[model samples]
Target: MGKKKTKTSSTETSRTVTTPTRPDWVDAQAKGLNDALTDLGRADPAASVAPLSDLERRASETAGGLGVGGGWGSGWGSGGTDWANWGRATPATGPAPAATAPDLSGARLEGRGEVPQAASVLDNLSAYMTPFRDQVLAAAMGDYDAEAGRRRAAQDLEMAGQGAFGGSGAALTRSLTEGELARGRNSRLAGLLDQMFAQGASLSAGDADRRQQASTAAAQLGQAREIEQAQLTQARDIERARLAHEGGLEAARLAQAAEAGRMQDALARAQLGQEGELARQRLGLDGAASRRADAETQARIGAQVRAAEQARLSASEQALARRIEMFSGLPLGLFQGSVTDSQGQRNGTETTSGATLGEIAQLVNSLTGSPLSRLFQKKGQA
Candidate 1:
């Protein structure tokens, strides 16, 4: 079988990135700042720093005096008097008095009086009706009696005219006539009595109606009065309750105001204390900063003086070394010579004059084992 075709591919990718450069002025400014910092670093501290003003000098002197004379330095190390207690004390404020409540005992309402009694229409009814009935009956009976008397006189005259005055027939007729008249009179009298009684009864009934109307009016008036009294009492009670509530509210308001005033006073006192403490701490910090600045200034001045002295000493030593080197370069005379004798013999002898430059160089090279020893020896032989 044929092998499957295989293919391989390779991909390459490339990208170019461009970076933005700073402006010339920016670079110049940076370079200037760097050079300025370098020069400041190399400059003398004493020359760079300005002299203290009069105020600052006085402050420094005062601080120094306090440190030495007032035991301020010792106080810090030995836990003595602290600087925090150097201010005026705050005054204490008292609490406000409580409010008084109003009296409520006088607000109570009084009890109402007893209710009025109702009037009766039948009161003394019998006595008043009896009198009226008797008067009417008497007037009716008097009229009946007068009528009977007139009739009896007329009958007697008629009997005399008829000639029956003293006979049996006349007596019998007179008796019959008297009897009829008596019957008629009795019937009339009875009718008159009935009418009188009816009138009396009507009067009594009218009086009773009047009394009943009066009694009802009185009862109505009493009920109205009672209602009015009840309303008045309720109104008074409501007014009392309102007055009591208002008094309580006023008392509470006064108390709240007093409490608020006390709290405000307390807060003011606390704030005053905090301000005093902060002032003290600020003063201490400022004094410490002033002392530190003075010390640093003195140290800088001393360092500058020491550096100047060191530079002067180094220059003097360099000058002395140069003089020594110049003197040493000059030729000295200490050399040995050969003396001639008879029969061509030579002997060693010391020379009094100074040696030549080559001899001195050779002597120095031999002593020091210098690289120039060969040149000096060759020159001396030449």
Candidate 2:
């Protein structure tokens, strides 16, 4: 046999390539950050937020201009809405601020005045502002200290540059130069301290001014919001008054409509009942007529049956009469016979005989081949 050549499989011939790999933790962190960013990009804030319906929007519009800033409920009206409990006022937190009824004579709003928003803003200042002040102070101190450190480092570098490797005379001269430079640096550091102190004072004064400006702005904003709320409340009251007036007319119209609907329903029911009664009467009449016709047909059928039966009976009676007449024309004999036995008892028998032997033959012929006649004939033959 010739030598066989072996073929290598394609998978075995294929070379495996190795690539550079990153640390598992590094890859995992990068992947996680990428996934987080992707998810954030895809996320819809509106999906989480409930959307307002058209009706709700209308109600909100009717109540007040939407998105009016500040505490709308606090200054003018109540918290939440009155729609949940219609016709009722919100319960008061304290002894209900005595309401001053508006004077209709001038048509001017009552109790509406300039509210001090500055005082309100200043009231909460210490809680939030302390941290901000502390931060600013820290930043200024750090900057001052860093500048001082840089100056000190420069002085040390200068002294180091003046270092001598020569004899005592050179050392003394170097020492003199270093002493003067140290004095100058100390003077500069003192001036730097003074500058830092001045800067700190300026910062403090600026912060105070900023707080004052903020307070004034906040006060103005609050007053503006209060005015807006009062306007909304006034509009709401006007709308309520208008609706109240219309409500009375609506109630009367509804009452009339309800009464008319009830009357129409009653009329419809009466018509339906009348129609049902008519249908029932018609059905009853139709059924009675059908039954009467059926009864007449049955009576005619019964009469026909009776007539057929009477005719059959009459035919039978005539046939019997004709047979009787034939027998009457023939000579029929009544034979009386007596028999005596050895016991000395006498027996007598009576038999009716046909008038002719031909009649007797006819009767025998009619009974011929019957089971009882056959038996008698066999006996006679035997």
Candidate 3:
């Protein structure tokens, strides 16, 4: 058989096989260090520092975002949050429509195109006087004929008497005288006829003129009646036109009043709606304010808690570092034993353990008090 090969290995390792009995002093020191380490773990400095950086970054982002918004200084409000705008009244309805214009076409009046013509009064009067003038002329002619016949008979009788009484010279002279007398009588009768004819003609003309004047008056009366009738007709037409115009105006007024009333009603309703909306908006703003206040208070409380945790962590870390420094000076490897390797028939083992009184005292002092405290006030001091 080949020579048996032998290999050996030794390593330092901590293993718990069973619960160990510890001295009172050692237990106290161990408990102090464990408590300090546990506190350090619970209040890690990173917990405070990391959150602070995150908070600062978030605040910066919020402020920057607000600044970049378009409103600028004019848009700022009480808090960082944006404020709501006030409710506005509903836009006014378009202007009230114009009232319907009155229809006055029928109410307007127009004058007649042609004036009325009346018959000629002078022409009518002349026709009426003509018959009376002719009757007067005939009566004058008949009287002249009767006077001429009587004058001729008287002259004949005088001429016969002169002839019977005269055969001598004296009788001839008397005959000549009688002839002269007859001529004179004839001339006188002709003159009398002429005078009668002239008187008749003058009377006839006077009668004709008087009759013509009466006829003219009658015609004037008829024309006056026609004028009165025309005036009455015109008055009636004017009155009708006035009544129609008044009716149209009244209708327009009624329409205007109705439109005004409608507009007022609409305005009232709109105002009422606006008031209700404003109330709702105000209530919302108040609720937002309450929520904001609660959030700010919570933030302050959280910040205080974090600050306390950071302080505790700093104290705990310092205590843990002091404990490490104190234990490093102890000489636990001074108690030593050898290790053996087992090949076929041999087994190997190694062990080490030790403690120094000075190390124990240093640890005890570190736990109960500081090194400076032990040096300055050791046993008694005045």
Best by TM-score: 1
Candidate 3's residue-wise lDDT over 135-169, tens digit each?
64456545655665675456456756766433465
- Tell me which residue pairs clash in candidate 3: 339-349, 340-348, 340-349, 342-346
lDDT per residue for candidate 1 within 357-378, as digits (tens), equals: 7776667766655557666567
**Descending-TM-score candidate ranking:** 1, 3, 2
What does candidate 2's lDDT look like per residue over 1-382, in tens digits?
2343444332222334444343455455546556655764687744433344332333344335323333212221233433233213321111111112222233233443343333233344454445544675456556656765676566556656766345575567556756765676576656655655565555565666676777677667767767876776786577546545554454455345444534543444444443555543443343344334333433333343344334433443355456546645643222223333332333444444435767656777799888977876888899
Best model number under lDDT: 1
Off by over 4 Å in 2: 1-170, 253-382
Ordered by lDDT, highest first, the candidates read: 1, 3, 2
Pick by lDDT: 2 or 3, better one: 3
lDDT of each: 0.52, 0.47, 0.48
Pick by TM-score: 1 or 3, better one = 1
